[model samples]
Target: MRVLVAPDKFAGTLTAVEAAEAIAAGWRRHAPDDELDLAPMSDGGPGFVDVLHATLGGELLVTTVEGPHGEEVPATVLHVGDVAYVESAQAIGRHLVTEGGAEFATTVGAGELLLAALGTGATTVIVGLGGSGTNDGGAGLLDALGAVADAGQLDGGPVLFAGLSSVDLAPARAKVAGVRLVAATDVDNPLTGLFGATKTYGPQKGIAEDRLYEVDGWLEQLAEATDRRTSLVKGAGAAGGLGHALLCLGAVREPGIALVAEAVGLASRARAADLVVTGEGAFDFSSRSGKVPYGVAEIAAEALRPCIAMAGQVLVGSREMRALGVENAYSLVDLVGEQRAFEDPVGSLQALGERVARQWSRE
Candidate 1:
C-alpha cells in the first residue's frame, strides 16, 4: 500500500517539512512495508517558499529590501524560469512583527521585493499574501511603487491618513503592464466592513481592538482613492487589505492551497496513493478556508481515498470531520495533553503518528 503524507506548518513549532518527516517516520513504525510519500504543503503563509522550493527545484534568489520597520532585510524569491514566486512573509510576516510595534508596521519591504521580482523579467509572479505585519491597506506598498505620494504617512505610523483621497495608480499600473500578478491567499474576508481586514485581523497584529474601526476606515479611504470597490470582494482583506490593493492594480486573487497544490502536483500523488494523511497545528472550522488540510482532504476525496487528518488541536468532532472529507482525525492535545503537545511537538507528533499507523494501517 502507498500512503501520502502531506502536512502544513505546525504554527510556532515545526515546519511543513519537519511535520511530514515526523508523520512518515511514525507511520513506518507500524506499517513498515507501506510505501510513504512525503509532500509538505503550505497555504501562502510562512512556509510557502520553503515548501515550493523543497518540492520543485528552483533558483532561490535573495535581495535586500526594506523591512516592515524600515530596516534593510534580506528577502527570498523563487525564480522558475519565466515564473517567479514571492512570499510576502519574508518581508513583513509575523516573525518580523512580534511586538505591538507591528501596529505601525509598513509593507514597503514587500513592495521592494515585488519590484525586484518584476525586474527579473518574470512574465508571471505569484505572491503569498498571508502572515503580514501591516494594516495600512497596502498604503506602504503603493508608496514604494510610486503610487501613494505621502511616504511619511505610509512609513511612519499605524493607519492614520485620511488624506489619501486621491492616489495616482498610473505608475504602478505601468510597472505591472506586461506581468501577471497573482495574490495567493486563503482569506475570504473583504477589504472593509465588520468582517473585513482591520476588524478581523487587526487585533492579531497588535492593533488595539477598539482602534480597528479606524484602521478599517483607513483602508476604506484607500479603496476610494484608488477608485476601487473591493469591500465586497472575497479575499480583498487578506494581508491587511493588500489583496484589495492588488485587485485595484489589475492583479488576480487565487486560493493559496490550490496554487501550491498545482505547483507541487498534489493531484497526481493523491491519485496514486491508497491512503492520505494531512495535518496542521489547529484543526477547526476555519480549516475549510482553503488551508492545507482541507485541500489535501479534497484531493483524497477526489481520488476515492480515505483521508486522516491530524493536528495539534482538533476542535471539530467526527461528523464535521466526515463532512470535510476526513475519514478520521486526531489531535495532539488528546494524545499527550496540551502542555506537553506544545512543549515537545516533535516527540508527540511521532507518537501520534505511530498510534495512527497501528490503528489504521492499510498493510
Candidate 2:
C-alpha cells in the first residue's frame, strides 16, 4: 500500500512538515511495508515559505524586520532563481500580537520583508498573505516602501490612519517598477465593508466586537486617502489590508494553495499514490474554500484515489466531508480528549495516524 501524506499547518500546534512526519511515523509503525510520501502544504499563511522551501529547495535568506508592534522580529525570504517568496505572517501574523488589539498592529514589517525579497534581485516576488494581526489598510507597508503620508507616521495602525490627510504611493510604486508582484492570498474579501479586513478578521486579532465598524471605517478612510479602487479588489482584505497595498502596487492575486499545489506537483503525486491523506487544524465547511485539504482531495479524486483527513478537530459532518472528496476524516480531539490533543499534539496525532492506518492500510 502507498499513502500520500499531505497536510497544512495545524494552527497553533504543529507545522505542516511536522504533521506530515508525525503521521508517517505512526503509519510506518503499523504498516512497515507500506510506502509513505510526505508532502506538506500551505495556503499562503504562516508556513508558506517553510513549505515552499522544503519542496522547492530554495535559498533561505534570514533577516530582521519589524514585528506587528514595531519590535524587531526575525524573518526569512525564500529565494529560488529569480523569484522570491515572502510570507506576510512572519511579520504581522495573529500569533505575534501578544498584548494589543488589531487596532494598533501594523503591517510595516511585511513591507520590510518585501523589500528584503526585492533586495535578493528577484524579478518576481510572491507575498503570501494570511494569519495577520493588523487592520491598517496597508498604510505601514506603503510607508516602509517610501509611500508618504501628510498627517500620519503610518506605523501606528488603523487608529492613526483616521487622521491621514493624503498618501503618495508614487515613490513606493517606483521602487517595484519592473518587478512582478504576486499576492498569494487565502481569502478574497475586499479591504473595507462587512466582509473586509477589520470586520471579518479583526476579532481574532483582538478587535473589540463593538469596535468592528469603527476600525473598518478607519480602513475605509485610509483607502480614500490612497486608492479607493484598490480597496475593492478581491483579496484586498487579506493580511489586514496588506493585499490592498499589494494591489495598489499592481500585484496579481492568486490562490495560495493553487500556487503551492503547482509548485509541489501535487496532481502528479496524488495520481501515483493509492490513498491520499490531508488535513488542517479544523475540518469544517470552510475547508471547501481554497484550503489545503480540499485542494488535495480534489486532486486525489481526479486521480481516482481515496482521500482521507486527519485534523485536530473534525467540525463537519460525514456528508460534507465526502462532498469535499474525502472518504473519511479523523480527529485527534475526538480520539483523545481536547486537553490531551493540545498538550501533546505530535504524539496525539501520531497515535491518531496509527489508528487511521489500521483501518485504511491493507497490511
Candidate 3:
C-alpha cells in the first residue's frame, strides 16, 4: 500500500517537517514494506516557506530583521529566482513575541523583510500572512516600505484610534512598481467587527478582553486613514490586518493551502496514492477553513482514496471529520495522555502512526 503522510505544525511543539518524519519512522516500523510518501504542509503560518521548500526547489536566504518588539530575529526568505516567498512569522511570529511584546508588536520587522525582497528584484512577491503577534494593522509595514506616517503610528507605539492622521501609499506603490504582491492566508476574516481581527484573534495575542474593542477601533482608524473599506473583504483581518495592508497595496489574496499544494503537486500525488494520512495540532471546526489537513483530505476525496487524520487533540467530532472527507481521525492525547503528548510530541506522533498502520495496513 502507498501511504501519503501530510501534516501541519503541531503549534508550539513540532513543525510539520518534524511530525511527518516521526510519523514516517513509526509507519516504517509497523509496515516496513509499504511505500511512504511524506509531504508536510503549512497554512501560511510559521513554517510556510520551509514546507514549500521541502518540495519546491528554492534558495532559502537567511537574514536578521527587527522583531515584533524591536529585538533582532533571524528570518528566512525563499528565492526561486524572480519570485520571492516571505513568511510573516519569521519577523513577528507568536513564538518570538512575549506577552508584553504583543502589546506593541509591530510589523516593521516584516515590512523590512518585504522591502529587502523588493530590492532583490523579485517581480512577484508571495507573503504568507499568518501566525502574527501584532494588532497595528500593518502600519509598521507601510512605514518600512516608505509610507509617510508618524513614527509612533508605525511602531505599535500606542497610537490610538483617533490619533492616526493619515497614510500615504504613493511611496509604497513607487517602491513596488511592476511587482505583483500576493497575500497568502487561510482565514477570510474581515478587517474589523465581530468576525474581524481583534474580536477573533486579539485575545490570543494578549489583548485584554476589554481592550479588544479599543484595538479593533484602532484598526478601523487605520482603514479610514488609508481610505480603504473596513469590512466585506475576505482575509482583510489575517495576520492582524496585514491582509488589509497588502490588499491596500493591490496584492491579491489566495487560499494558502491550495497555493502550497499546487506548488508541491499534492493533487497528482494524492491521486496516485492508495491511502492518505493528514493531521494537525487540533482538528476542530477551524480546520474547515482551508487548513492543511482539510485541504489534503479534500484531495484524497477527489482521488477516491481513503484519508485518515491524526492530531495532538481531536476537538471536532467524527461526523465533522467525515464531512471533511476524512475516513478516520485519531488523537495522540487520547492514546497517551496530555503530559506525554506534549512532553514528547515526536514519540507520541510516532506511536499514533504505528497504531494507524495497525488499524489499516492489512485493509
Candidate 4:
C-alpha cells in the first residue's frame, strides 16, 4: 500500500518537516515494504515559508527583524520568480511572547520582513498570517511601513492605542500601491468584536478574560484611525490584526491551506496514494476552519482515498472526525499520556503513528 504522510507543525514541539519525517519513520517501522510519500503542510502559520521553500525550491532570504517583544529575531522570506512569501509567526508567533506580554507584543518585525520581501522586487507578496502573540491591531506593522501615528503609540501595545491621537497611512499605502498583497490566513474573523482577534485569541496569548473587550476596543480605535471598513473584512483578525493591516493596504485574503495545498501538489499526491494521513498539534471541530488536517483530508476524500489523522491531542469525537473526512483519528496524548507527549513529542508521535499504522496498514 502507498501511504502519504502529511502534517503541519506540532505547535511548539516540531516543525511540519520534522513531524512528517517522524510519522513516516514510524510507519516504515511497521510497514517497511509499503511505499510512503511525505508532504508536510502549513496553514500559513509557523512553517509556511519553510514548507513552500521545500516544495517550490525558492530563494530564501534571511534577515533580522523585530520580535514580538521589541527584541531582534531572525526571519526568512521565500522569493520565487515574481512572488514573495512570508510567515507572520516568524516575527510575532505566540510562543515568542512571555506570559503577560501579549498586551505589548508588536507586529513590527512582520512589517520589516514584508519590506525585505518588497526589496526583492517581487510584484506579488503573500503574507502567511497565524500564531500571533500581538494584539495591537497591526499598529506596529503600519508604523514599520511608514504609517505615522502619535510618537511611540504604534510602537507599543493596544493599551497605548487608547491615547492615540492621529494616524497617516498615505506613505504606507503608496509604498505598495501597484503591488499585489495577499493575506493567506486560516481564520475569517473580523478585526474587533466578539468573534474578533482580541476576544478569540487574546486569552491564549495571555490576555485576561476581563480585558478582552477593552483590548478589542483599542483595535477598533486603530481601525477608526485608518480604514474602519477594512476592519470588518473576513480574516482581518488573523495574526493579531496583521490581516487587517494588510487588508488596509488593499490585500485580498486567501485560505492559507488552499494556497499551501496547491503549492505542494497535495491533490496529485493524494490521487497517487492508497491512504492519506495528516495532522497537527490539536484536532478538534475547529480543524474544519481551513486547517492543514482538514484541508489534507478534503483532498484525500476528493481522491477517493481513506484519510486518517494522528495528532498531539484529539478533541473531536469519531463522528466529528468522519465529518472532517478523516476515517479515524489517533492522539499521541491518548496513546502515551499528556506529560510524555509534551516531554518527548517526536517519540510519542512516532509511537502513535506506529499504532495507527498497525490498524490501517494493509500488510
lDDT values of the candidates? Answer: 0.85, 0.91, 0.86, 0.90
TM-scores for the candidates: 0.95, 0.98, 0.96, 0.96
**Which digits, one per residue and each the tens of the lDDT, describe model 3 over residues 1-363?**
899998999997899999899899988888999898989998899899999888787888888999888899999889987999999989988877788556578888988889877777899999998999887788778878888764236666334335676777899878788999999999999988899888999899888898888778778778778756734489989998888878888889999999888888889889878999999999887888889988999988888999999999999787887888888889999999999999999999999999989988963
How far off is residue 296 in model 4, in Å? 1.0
Segments in model 2 whose C-alpha atoms lie over 4 Å from true places: none
lDDT of 1 by residue, 1-363 (tens): 899999999999999999999998888888899999999999998899999999998899989998888788889889988999998888888778757765678888888888988988899999898988777777777777878554236554445565756778888888889899999999989888899888898888887877777777777777777756765688888998778777777789999999999999999999999899999999988899888899999989898899998899999988889888898889999999999998999989999999999888866
- State the lDDT at 198 in candidate 1: 85
Per-residue C-alpha lDDT of model 2 across residues 139-249, encoded as one tens digit per residue: 889989999988866888888875786899999999999999999987999999988988888888888888998888888888888899989999999988999999999
After superposition, the stretches of candidate 4 with alpha carbons farther than 4 Å from their true spots are 150-152
> Higher-lDDT candidate among 1 and 4?
4
Q: Where does candidate 1 stray beyond 4 Å?
A: 150-152
Most accurate candidate by lDDT: 2
Candidate 3 local distance difference test against the native: 0.86
Put down candidate 4 lDDT per residue, 178-219, tens digits, no spaces: 899999999999999989999888898999998888888888
